[model samples]
Target: MSAKIRLYVDHLLGPGQSVELTREQAHYLFGVMRLAVGGHVALFNGKDGEWLAKVAEAGKKGGKLTCQTQSKPLHMPPDLWFLFAPIKKTRTDFIVEKAAEMGAARIMPVQTQFTNSERIRQDRLQAHAVEAAEQCGGTFVPEVADLQRLDRVLDDWPETRQMMFCDEAEVGSALRLAAQEKGQPWAILIGPEGGFSDRERARLSGLPYAHVVSLGPRILRADTAAVAALTMWQQALGDWL
Candidate 1:
């Protein structure tokens, strides 16, 4: 039978290798999904691509599944980073999800001068990324980095990677990313709710590797701007086209 459930596991997957499901996984599969023993399920561990497996053992607390055969090979995303300030818990989670679905290699929460939130649950956000990857048919789950000060992050920024600074203040001056160096790694920065402060914008502007591009004529909320920026980047320099 064809496997319908796609699960993201942390264990290595290969023919004959059994994966022990966690308590939560057990509930999702047997308890909630009502998957019975010998039922098929799709699995991936980020490193091993996708595999078709069956429920070898089933229990309420936990269970086991053994890989039968490989389904798809590992598909890595572009070498891209999406850096944004933490907003409301749900919105921040949304950004993480979209980043994962859109093939961001790494997700980072930046502490901007005008940032609305000062901290984030790194583990929780990482889980969101995994869920997004599973639903979007991706093998690689991008890393959700801990909250860091924007200035500090820029201070040690790699000179080789290009940065797309989404400047809300540069609305009229907005330009497409067509001229960007597609061969190099890229990162997109989305500002906070109140937008980047004057000092923050100036600092980003002076950075040699940074390009201060506007999103559109009308301003967009931080979360919306993130989706817009990622779409533009993907269409222009990412793997989308």
Candidate 2:
């Protein structure tokens, strides 16, 4: 049988240390999953590599586990960032989850001129990324960044990394951009629901590292655009290549 997987953020895991789970994690393990004493599980931290562990004790509130052995080395994906304007709460969570699953190294919430959502809970988004990584058997979790203005992110753009701008107004095919972006550190940018302002689009188009791409004929929602853009990027310039 396959070993059950459980992720924890606590440090100092080893043979004799007792690791405490968060309240929700405890509920899932002890209540929902009914993991009992002596059951085996796998765990990982954003820092340490994955470890094989066993439940030492199970309680109503929480449980204790002992690390037994290392399962996989800590591996991070290629330098790919997902920059998107924040949307509704559930949609934002979905974006973060999908970004982690798709292997983005960093997730940035950009505040664009036409962006509808202004306030974002970074902690909650980070939690979603962690959960997604755990579910996907990933050793590393993507870093969730706090909300920042689009202009500032552009101003501080790294010269070496290319940016694939998912421009809805563009009529060209996504594959063209994908082929051109091969063999370079890249980022995929998705605009807000209302799309990028004229000025913002013009500025982005003028950037040396920015390559505007289209995700086919139909206009996709901001959430769908993010996923499609990432898929194209992963197939072209990312680990999937």
Candidate 3:
């Protein structure tokens, strides 16, 4: 039988396998969703494929589900990492949510010279990613990294991963990314509200793996830039192609 609800679980899923739900999850399903025993619920755990499960036991404090059949195989996203400076609380949450929905394999919050927020609740952001995956019909949930300085992150950059740096100063410049080869590791970097520092821009430009591009003829807000950059990359060299 098909289920209307899709849930992100933390347990293995296989034929006839029983899965235990956390109290919060139980509350969400039983209390909020009003799902009763024997009701069907689709489940996924990031690692395993999506499964159609039946609620075996439902309670206020906890619940259990039994996997009946595989609904869909795990479809992994491209090796794309999304890096951006955290803005206000709501906007940062919006960025994380969109990143997960847009097929980002990993989400990172970098601390730029002009970054407004120094600290970020990584756990909360991770939860946002999970919810985004659940709502957007994504089998994979991207990991949200803790806040780190931009320079330090660049210093340890992987040699093989290319970075798409969206430069605010290059508003009128052409977005030169269509020629980049696909099916390789890539990252999209969006600067903070105040934009990147001169040193940061210079360092990024000099990097062999960084491709600096302008979003358009105008400077976008940090959150808007992230979505624009992701859409551009996905269309050019990402899975959309």
Candidate 4:
């Protein structure tokens, strides 16, 4: 029978490997979900793809699962990194979830001059990404990084990865990403609700590897901008095509 639950595990998965569940994982699978011995679960470890595992032993606070067979191979997203300024808590959570769902290889909370929040719950946001991957049938989950200064990130930017800067100020400028044939590592940058600072805008615009594009005439919230930018990138240059 097919498993209804997909879980992210840190353990390595293989044809004969047995994965031991932690107390919290056991509680949720055995107590909360009431999964007993012989029950099946889909498991993925980011690097190992997805496997169908059967409960070999069950206890109140722990359990053991043996791998039956591989279900899905590791399907990593494009070499895309999503960098955005953090906003409200719920909205920030929403951005992380959607970024994972939309195939971001990494999610970074950038500290811009106009950014509203000063800190972020990196662990909590990572959990949200895991849940999003589980619920959305994704075998790979993106890493949610801790808050970092945008300037530092840019200063240390690798020349290999191109940056797609979504600037609202460039309203009339048309984005022609689809026609670009060269395949280079890419990243998308979404500014805060207050928008990019003048210095940030000018710096990005002057960057040799940055492509400053518009998201239409209307200004969008930080969260909305993330979704829009991902969609455009996926359709143009990402694996969606």
Candidate 5:
């Protein structure tokens, strides 16, 4: 039977490679999951492709797994960054998890002028991204960046990367991107719950690479807008095509 458990590990994955599990991983596999020696598990390290591994040693504190063969090739997503202003605690986590599942190359949290939250637990959000990749059968996990000012991020934006700015003021505008060329680096930005200030909107509008678009006729909450924006971009210019 095929291994049903998929795990994201930090060690290298290759033929004949033995991976040492941490104490927490050991507890989850042995104590919680009831996996025993000789049981099979799927492993991925975000660099190497997924590998089918056999449990070589099972102990109370730690364990080891030996790689048997590569199960899947490393599939990298399009070079797309997901940028958004942090919202509530649970919703912020939701955004990070969904961004990982939806094929974002990187996840960035920006503090906008009207942003609700000032700081975020970067480690916790990153853990959510890893768990999301494991559950969604993805070989790559997007890195979650710490919260930064939106203005600063815009100032240092890459010249080659295009930005899809979801402007709340542009409500009722059709969400279209057919004119955009695919295969280029891109980013999708979702504003905070309170929406972007007039000054912020003006600054974004003046940018040469920013494509301001609306989600729909009505204003959407920050979390909902994030998912909607990702879906739209993926269908138009992302890997979903």
Candidate 6:
């Protein structure tokens, strides 16, 4: 595997120009990773595309790197989105990481009536998404959306894309639902730990584009629900198919 370093949007990088990485990034690269000057690393700006860079200077407090050439063009991902209720801090981070790893184009934090976490640090979640992309060797990083009310998100939902609601209330085979959702841009909705409110469930079920599906016989946590739903989607209508 090639050496890669995840960077935030604070630094400007281009061919033949030196960009100074932040103090924290400097520590991780030079101090922790023991990467010396002249070592090559890969970088990507969510907008500017992926680039191969060489460490120009290694310093105790900070360091500089120069971008060499573009490794890949800015390619957009599929239209799949993972719309999930935010859980605890660590679990939420795990969900963001897994969503990026699973190739979700967008990770949305939907705030339901039964949702436990009201406050979500979007920057932290975005950072986790970036790290996941770098770790998985993915050129595109999934967008981490801010916390929005479920109703608001649904009200503004695009009519073209289908929403696969992972309903725990359903008890049957998943293939039936999978067959109905084949070959469409989709979003998977996972309820919070306490599950969706009655009104919310009804609203989701009423949507013409929403396809209510079951993960299995057992109940799952919000984080686990996300992974299971995404896995099922990938196997059925996603890229795996």
Clashes of each: 0, 0, 0, 0, 0, 0
What lDDT tens digits, residue by residue, belong to model 4 across residues 106-167? 99999999998999999999999999999888999899999999999998999989888998
- Please, what is the TM-score per model? 0.97, 0.92, 0.98, 0.96, 0.97, 0.89
Give the RMSD in angstroms, all C-alphas superposed, for model 3.
0.9
Predicted structure 5: lDDT:
0.92
Comparing 1 with 4 on lDDT, the higher-scoring candidate is: 4
Q: List the residue pairs that clash in candidate 4.
A: none
lDDT of 5 by residue, 94-183 (tens): 999999999999999999999988799999999999999999999999999999999999999998999999988896665468778989
lDDT of 2 by residue, 139-229 (tens): 8899899999999999888999888898888877454654574567888899998889999999999999888888889989887888888
Decoy 4 TM-score against native: 0.96
C-alpha lDDT values of all predictions? 0.91, 0.84, 0.92, 0.92, 0.92, 0.83
lDDT of 2 at 5: 61
| Superior by TM-score: candidate 1 or candidate 2 | 1
Residues 14-95 of candidate 6 have per-residue lDDT tens digits of 7886778888888888888888999978877666677788899999898889889877776666689899989888999999
Candidate 6 Cα deviation (angstroms), residue 94: 1.0
lDDT tens string, model 3, 1-241? 7888999998999999999999999999999999999899999999888999999999888989999999989989999999999999999999999999889999999999999998999999999999999999888899999999999999999999999998888766655678878898999999998989999999999999998888887769887888888999999888885
Clashing pairs in 2: none
Models ranked on TM-score: 3, 5, 1, 4, 2, 6
RMSD of 2: 2.0
In candidate 2, which residue ranges exceed 4 Å CA deviation?
A: 13-17, 173-183
Q: How much is 137 displaced in model 2, in angstroms?
A: 1.5
Give per-model CA RMSD: 1.1, 2.0, 0.9, 1.2, 1.0, 2.4
Once model 2 is optimally superposed onto the true structure by TM-score, how far is the C-alpha of residue 180 displaced, in angstroms? Answer: 4.7
